[model samples]
Target: MGICDAPARAKVLNMSQHNGSFGCNYCKIYAPFNEDLKCRVFVPTSNLQPRTTDEWKKLALAASNTKITRANEREFLGVKGWNQLLRLPYIDIVSFCPPDYMHSQLLGTVRLLLAYWLGGRSQLFKYNFHMVWHLPQVVRQYGPLITNSAFQLENWMGKIAKQIHESKIHIAEQAINKCSVISSTITNFYSNIDCFETEFIKYF
Candidate 1:
């Protein structure tokens, strides 16, 4: 490399060298086999408040970080590209940000990704759809899109950042409800046991 410009693969560990790596030196970092990769999915459950540039940046960041984590998710889960998230009714792009500044960067980067996802990479290499006809052209539109709660941001997402948020309680409630069914059934059995015991006592 040049004296001024830094060399590629300059890290101490050279994460791109491992097998099963979708992460190439030129683009993706860290080998795909980096299995211990921790991932968190952050999707707002509701619409957001009015955004300043800063707030909008945070919104975008969540999605940006999610995209990176998704690579790991795809590898570990054996899924295809990010299209799966698109199909989910309430799932949005996700990311992990322990600190706020890191959060903001994700937002900023997501804004960049949204642009790329739209606009056809370069105009010469456009993403085209030859489907039902007139609607297909309209359906494929992309660009700045609303970052709604993962449950909300479905179907075609176009335009720039739209306020997307999510309900953690709703998700929690569903989780609780899902698991509690068995617990509730077990509880009922115990509760009815007391009644049965009293009836047997009376009979005896």
Candidate 2:
């Protein structure tokens, strides 16, 4: 149900229909519906399963450059039965194609800000600029729902950065470690607190 970027939709569409020759698992057409509309679902000719990295890369490329005339349907179709690649019913694919708020809102905003500040700078700035891509993985590891943009880990990172700034820490790793220690201490403190203490603390 969660999609990271526009490429995800493309991948889904590609899987649904390999080029224009094959039918889609979710929709009848090769193209996706409008942003406000939803695509129709249909039982796939084959079963779904995990694909190799090369296959996924090809699919991604196909999705991005849709004009490429290629009939690689055999590569995507399963041996038999409905594909279980996503483990979701065919009907749910359209509803699940919702825009990813974390990418569209939080990450997009941060990326724009970074670009404005360091558009054409040194290699270090370029590296720092691309570091935003790692954020989603780090956030997912912490067990937060990726779909809910409001609960993004970037907010917490912002707070940590603010603390780092206030502390005048020259080293990034030390600041990150400080934030980790602070978070663990707070979590441990709460874990031992009684319900009454929790309520009292909430009022403050």
Please give the CA lDDT of all the candidate structures.
Answer: 0.27, 0.39
Query: Candidate 2, after superposition: displacement of residue 71 in Å?
Result: 5.3
Q: How many pairs collide in each candidate, listed in order?
A: 23, 6
Candidate 2 C-alpha lDDT tens digits along 7-49? 4444653343222222322222233222332332222323433
Q: Which sections of candidate 1 miss by over 4 Å?
A: 1-10, 17-109, 122-204
**Top candidate (lDDT):** 2
Candidate 1 per-residue lDDT over residues 3-31, each given as its tens digit: 00111122211222112222221222222
**TM-score quality measure for candidate 1:** 0.14
Give each prediction's root-mean-square deviation over alpha carbons.
23.8, 15.2
* Residue pairs with clashing backbones, model 2: 16-24, 47-82, 47-83, 48-83, 48-84, 48-85
